[model samples]
Target: ATTSIAPTTAVATTSPVFVPVTEPPSATPPPTTDAAVAPAPATTIVAVDVPASTAPPIVVPASTAVPTTTLPPPPPAPVTQLGVVQDVAASGPLTVPVVDYGLPRVALGDSVMLGAAEELLARGFAVDAVKSRQMISFLPDMQIIRDGGSFGPVVVIHLGTNGPFSESTLNSMMALVVDVPIVVVLTGRGDREWIGRNNSKLRALPEFYPNVTVLDWEVVASQCPGRCFYEDGIHLTQSGQDFYASQISQLLGMG
Candidate 1:
């Protein structure tokens, strides 16, 4: 038995070992990681100062300038010569008024004359007046009177209150009583534009004809300082009528 145990050989046994189960690292990173990004640059603001002396001035144009107003000239001044006869005075030392009331007298006019009809009749004048009478329409009546030989030595005419009369018409009217002494009454101040123009023609009559005379009633009526006229300014008040009658009377040497 000893010989058999000695002849048996001894056998060797090995055990298995394990390395860590790690895989190779990837080329791209995982979604769990977030990368930080850089921000853009901001703009900066700065302030500047300006000088007052270098500023531009405001201008206004001459074409757009405000216009000035022009008013009309005033009426002509009143004539001073009332009833003077220079030729007659030059001829002799005797001086007489332009009218004679001793002879038959006629009064012709418009509504203004009608206002003083009774007063004129009292003063020995045949009153012939029509309301709103124009000089053109009244010329025919004057012609009728001239043809009939009823035109008296003295004539008092007050017209042009209703409307305008031409220089030719005035001349023709005066021709009707060429030889007779006539008294032309200047119209009072009124709203009518023709009043001043008519009075101007009336005032110049004596220059051309010796038989003509102006009563200058405009001057006379102005003395009352707005009391002489009724609201019409062309017609007379009671006091105005008295003054009117008295002026005519004085002119005729009756007052």
Candidate 2:
């Protein structure tokens, strides 16, 4: 018995061990060849909150617009009347009408006119003057000229130098040539007392006839003092005759 107990020993059996296997997930999807056959993307909708007091936005067109303008009114027309000359601009040549008086100037006087006769005749005057002749005795000559139809459109008379005539005699002389277009009467210049009285009558002629004009030779000759006349103070010197003729020519519209 003692020998069998010392040699008894049991043997154990070994079992196999099991471990779990795990692989990391792939970083990207696998490559595909049928890419065109994928489904289309769906519409996305986002929601936002808005206040009640906010206004809607305005849209503008691409084209631009033009502005308008205002104009002013024109001026008034020009005034027209007779004897009023208005300057007119002509596009072409213009014709002007000429007036024909149909008569020359006829002048009758005493020695003072005789002194200026040469100067006056050269200025287109028909002059007839007499020395030491009175106005009272000159009616027959005026009648002869009027009857002979030789009296012109303009008549000039310078008398009352040799002697004074009555106003009745002056009226008789004026009656012959009163129908003439123009009649110019002259006052005599001298120291004679009758000269003043005769000039007063001569100045009165314009009151009765509208075509009469008085040329006061007395006032004109007095401007030169002692230089205008000779020692007699009735006849004119050379300067005085020139002045006298110039005055007559201006009155007749010749100067």
Candidate 3:
């Protein structure tokens, strides 16, 4: 019992302790640089540069620089004279003569006279056809004989075919001429039947003028049956024209 009590009085020994680790702050990385703050890429940009000392020039065409030229006008036409003659006494009968004066070789009045003159020339008659406006107002006198030459005994007058003359004017014209037989070829009426009928009425002047002889153109027109006129219906066709000229030639004893 005494040995067991001594064994319980033995002393206890202490164990070693572990320490905690603490590291110094790591070195801070330098402030990070942004990629957007990098330099711009290289490229060339062209620009026009003008000087302040000079002004811009103006241009013009060659046609506007030259001048144009012009020419002058022409001359006017000439004037003339006209008349009639007659013979009231002869062994057979009385007769009249017509003498025309104006521009030589041209027919009197208008185209109808021209065609008549052409017909006369074809029939061996020495026709002095005058181109004249004065034929309408021509007075009968010896002055035309002095100017041109003497006309013979029988004078056949083919006139007023262009238009009708006033009664007083026609009478005055008749009064101007002396003693001669006057064969007044009546004007042909146009294609209208009414005109021909009217012409017969108007042709009563021979009763007043005793020395005048009236040749009926209506009768002449009737000879062709139905077609006596040119396309104009005023002028005569070749056949009509020839027949008319022949009738005149027979009346004047030129046939």
The residue pairs found clashing in candidate 1 are none
Native-vs-model 2 lDDT?
0.73
Question: What TM-score does model 3 achieve against the real structure?
Answer: 0.45
**Backbone collisions counted per model:** 0, 0, 5
User: Which residue pairs come into collision in candidate 3?
Assistant: 86-180, 87-180, 95-181, 96-155, 96-181
lDDT of 3 by residue, 111-147 (tens): 4555667787776444443333233455443236424
lDDT tens string, model 1, 1-255? 455545667665666577779989998786664666556778777776765686578787668758888888996543323453222212222123344333477888888778888998998888889999988889999888778776655677888888889999998888887876444454535778888898788778878876667766666666553477877777888777777776666665565
lDDT, residue 134, model 1: 86
Task: Give the least accurate 10-residue stretch of model 1, judged by summed lDDT.
Answer: 86-95
Over 1-255, each residue of candidate 2 has an lDDT whose tens digit, in order, gives 466556757665667578988988899987887668767888888887776766786788877767666666665332111111111111111121122543477889999999999998988888889998898888898798788776756778899998889979999998987877667788888899999999888877878876676777777566553476789888989888887887766655465
TM-score for candidate 1, please give it. Answer: 0.59
Models 1 onward score TM values of 0.59, 0.60, 0.45
Best by lDDT: 2
Model 1 misplaced stretches (Cα beyond 4 Å): 1-103
Instruction: Output the number of the TM-score-best candidate.
Output: 2
